[model samples]
Target chain A: MNFQGIFSMSRKDLTTLVIFSIVVLALPIWLQPFGAAYPDLMQKFAIFGILAIGFNILFGLTGYLSFGHAAFLGVGSYTAVWTFKLFSMNPIPALIFAVILSGLFALLIGYVSLRRSGIYFSILTLAFAQMSYNLAYSVLTPITNGETGLQLEAGDPRVLDSMFVAEEAGLPVSNFFGIEMSGIPGFYFCAIFLILGFFITQRIFASPFGMMLRGIKSNQTRMNYTGFNTRPYTLTAFVISGMYAGLAGGLMAVTDPLAGAERMQWTASGEIVLMTILGGVGTLVGPVIGAWLIKYFENIFSSFNESVLHNLFGFLPDGVEGFVVELTSMFVGEGWHLTLGLVFVLVVTFLPGGMMEGYRRITTLFTGGGGDGDKKAKADDTQTQPAE
Target chain B: MDAIFLQFLNGLDKGGAYALIALGLTLVFGTLGVVNFAHGALFMLGAFCAVTLRKILTMQKVVLDEENLTAWGTPTEIRTTYVETWFGDFGTQLVNYSVPLAILLAIPVMLVVGVVMERGLIKHFYRRPHAEQILVTFGLAIVLQEIIKHYFGANPIPQPMPSNLAGAADIGVMMGMDPNIIVYPWWRLVYFAFSVIVIGAVFAFLQFTTFGMVVRAGMADRETVGLIGIDIDKRFTAMFGLAAVVAGVAGVMYTPLLPPDYHLGMDFLVLTFVVVVVGGMGSLPGAVLAGFMLGILQSFASMTEIKAIIPGIDQIIIYLVAVIILLVRPRGLLGRKGVMES
Candidate 1:
């Protein structure tokens, strides 16, 4: 199929895609004021954006909450790193291998886990992920290299690369042809993939399969009674999301060719869930925005210390300034997680649909429910409205 | 033979802890129909209750003595706990028994915490999807643990068991076996015995009391019981408090075995969920049964014989068993019909 045939975007969707691409590509310029322009943090934004967008496919659409998505990510990273070690330092083959291996892993897990729904499915996924993490840290030490993590050794042969060219002096870095996947170039590489991932997610969201997943989420029994077998639909969504996670993991390895078991930890999985919820569950732009917000907080907000807080509160009187700084410091720097927790709770409690709902509410409040406001409201509604 | 016996004892001790935590989890699930991811945080809070009491009991005043300063050519500082300064040996003994005394503090504190959490947060989420409930509670758990970290720092705070019960007891001799074959910590036995009593008391309170009857009825059918004019919501709030206390005391007693840390709750959270699932959701006896069974199985998996065959069985045994059980028997071991099966 041609690109247009695959996506078949409407005018509004095309506008949304164009706007989203511009915002993502211009992140370096836009985020400069916020002190997040550096490539490392920007790469994280793109990478986690991909993760959250993929997660939204299964979670937001199908409402099948998999608490073990991180396992696929870890698998991807391991596969990518192994690809670098055994075959080549080239990123193309590494990412392909990463996505394929993690998809196979997800297929095995999703087949068993999708049999149950709700919290049972959550538990099953959590179990499989934990098992993977445990084995990675112990029994799979030869493959994973245990707690010290898998890193490229200086003398290790890149079999495929060595076949083509003379081996480099030091440990070889991952590259696309000769272009090193690091710094600004690396961020662009990840950003391009993020845009591609977003495009795919957008197409999926607007497709009939997306409608079927939503139908299953609304009422699986009704969908079944309507002569639809929802299992393959859910499983396909699961594998697709898993592949997305794998792609993100592959990107992580491409930028920094080290893979740790920590990426597969349950808490890491929780963080993914938190990002999707913090954005807006079913909305297209929500997860990307959520991932960016969280990555910003994690990188920029966490860098604030007592001295920075003091400077910010320097205008106040001595006693008051000290108290204010102390209070604010607890929510930033080492305590940024506390802020994350607070924000997440507030989002879930007040804005169940997340930041997208908040935006929709603000638009309606200002526009008085007419003209552009009506169209925007209707679009948001179609995305998130509970099925009748 | 001795190794197996010791492993069995270790399993029971571990199982006791598992059962205590799972009992409260299943209790809240049965009563409130809320999936409280913060229940583990309550357990962590209960453990911190002991840490707090110890900190308060050992609050010291420093006195500078000018005459005792030859080494540094400055006044020597002498520190004495306020309790020691006032109550002498009795204060010292109180500090030693801080872990047990924490139960008293945990009961009331956890009760208040549980009630507030249910009324303030979980009550609002009852009508929401189980996913939302899990998300909110998970957020609360992070907040609670972070607050604890802010106050106590991230390191594990060791709570001393009573001085007399500090040493390991030779169980082999008592059981008519060779001496020195099976040595077990005295405190672990105490923990096991205490968990049994607590579990029994919770069961009896529900089985016998009128209040318990109402709560049980509410669990069976909240709307029907509400129609009968019994304030089921209030009782559920109370049951949430009761579950908190059970979890709290379990945490308090567990301090000696594993030092209290901000991350303690999170570590136990996944394992307890597995235990609860294996036992069957909302089944008290099933949770307790599954808790002990998995704990024992985990202990056995950690054995050299088992590890030789399975390698990392000890690390993933509970989750492995949970996956198998959940796939084979979707309702869990003792699950009731039509509860979360859909």
Candidate 2:
């Protein structure tokens, strides 16, 4: 309960907290213009935002680069679904079950993976994640339900339903006590968790513990030489990040109760990595922003087909419109993934510090290009403490 | 006893592919110190080469046959491939063996791709962090796979084995055992033999050639090799090409077994990385040994008897092996200490 000391915040951090709160609260208001007003899209942004933020703690700070984070996410989803199946449709127990199970899973995986550093650690985590996915899709069908996935069935003896009394007509929806965990209410519920996740991550970033992780990232040998045991620090970070992923997964189930084996696939993990790097690795607000942007585009912009493109470019001459549509077709519609890949390449190749660095550079150029001024100092601090 | 023997053979067959992929990965890691996540994409490209070659070879010309008009009042059209027009029966035979013939195109294509990837993108990240290398290469892999997906669509295209080598071969007879009882697929045996030859050739090339020796020297000590005035960079680039060719050929040959899909490369990538790590990073022999060992272990784990005893062991055996090996031997089975530890 005394998390204040862990998340000791400066005045600037408080301002960031206020700003983040405003933006998240404004999502239901201003986001409608951007085509993300719908509850499903809004919930996804919050869910994936949590996923990416959790991923950044280990990758952005410690630089462990576990390719297995999705396994924890998947574990969380399964736990939540099982909780729904057996006992309650309440979000609290489901989330708690999901997070705790995922944390334990992360502990087991991180203990072994952290024993080896650098690429080996990444590969080890990947192997474990893949093994989990393969098992879920095949031999563990009794539990994961194989490719069809584990869904709420009619015969599932949800005992708590009789006690709580089912309110809805057909299938049960996840609830916060009695409040339906769907639609606008669901987005708010997910946002609370995302904000909490962000606050916790911010604290970790500002803590002495976070400083040790930075040391591990910058130079593990130096840390080891200075009488620091790096393994425990790394393992702790991995578990924490894994727990964050679990939290995200739990939130996913809270919003939508289906748990699929594909959720554990390496590509899902890769997307987490992409979100962090694409947004701004090491910058706390960067990954959440990245997750929001990607989900926004994937759900909204990708829906716009050639007709949308034609309408956007209709002001051009008939011949020019045709040419523009043809040229841009490679980056939109069914080609959105191509755009994602290209963005990833360009970001890694040209913008290694990610969009956060780009923002900083532009601000520095505009505000302090003539000299090292207030903007420059602010940018440096932002890089050091990357959270909202 | 016979089941065990069959499992052993199956293990060796699987190991052949694993060893080939791992060897190429370890080679690149040794020579360039780049952890290429795009290696699997290169393998996928190689398999597609066979598909491309067949498509090119069987490009047909349609002609209407007025003399053979149908009852529906339409002329029957005769379709003939360009290759058939040029070389007749020989062209038809070549199409039948397009998988092997793809090697010719795959080697050159893979080499070019490797060179371009290294010269254009990877060279900049040599002094960067391992994370950067991984991120850049991973992005590259995604780009490459997406491009493949864009053109090929998202389905696995099954490739046919050669007509002559389509059925089972009696290896038991050669080994002085009962023939039909211990038969195995001819193509799998061919694949094993092909992998052996390729592996042997790679080792021999490294041992015998001046280029390989210098590359090996560079892998041992890049600064020392550079200070001694050997153009290690060129050799490193060439080694990348060689590694690409190896993976490409492996993929090309494997089309009949796994089928060619845009995603096939990724499915294998995780498993191959495990093999590379378990074998020991930067150690070629270690990669080969671990590949075979894991391959055998995987086959054993997948057995119905084994699964009955230890359910789902088939899915997790490689990871379990990797975890145990890494915890016990931190540097891997044959890896030297402090190679990439920094």
- Per-candidate Cα lDDT values, in order, are 0.91, 0.87
Once fitted onto the true fold, the runs of candidate 1 whose alpha carbons sit more than 4 angstroms away are A2-4, A370-388
Model 2 misplacement above 4 A: A1-8, A166-169, A306-327, A369-388, B66-75
* Residue pairs in candidate 2 whose N, alpha carbon or C atoms collide under 3 angstroms: A284-A386
- Give the per-residue lDDT of model 1 (tens digit) for A1-388: 6976976789899999999999999999999898889999999999999999999999999999889999999999999999999899999999999999999999999999999999999989999999999999999999999999999987677899999979878888888899999999999999999999988988888889999999999999999999999999999999999999999999999999999999999889999999999899989989999999999888878889998888888999999999999888788887888899988887887778888988987887787767675667665543422211
Clashing pairs in 1: none
Where is model 2 chain B poorest over a 10-residue stretch in terms of lDDT? B333-342
| TM-score of every candidate relative to the true structure | 0.97, 0.94
Model 2 interface DockQ: 0.47
For candidate 1, what's the TM-score of chain A, rounded to 2 decimals? 0.94
Alpha carbon lDDT at B247, candidate 2 = 94
| DockQ, each predicted model | 0.56, 0.47
Per-residue lDDT tens digits of candidate 2, residues B214-331? 9999998999999999889999999999999999999999999888888888888888988998888899999999988898889988899999999889889998898888778767
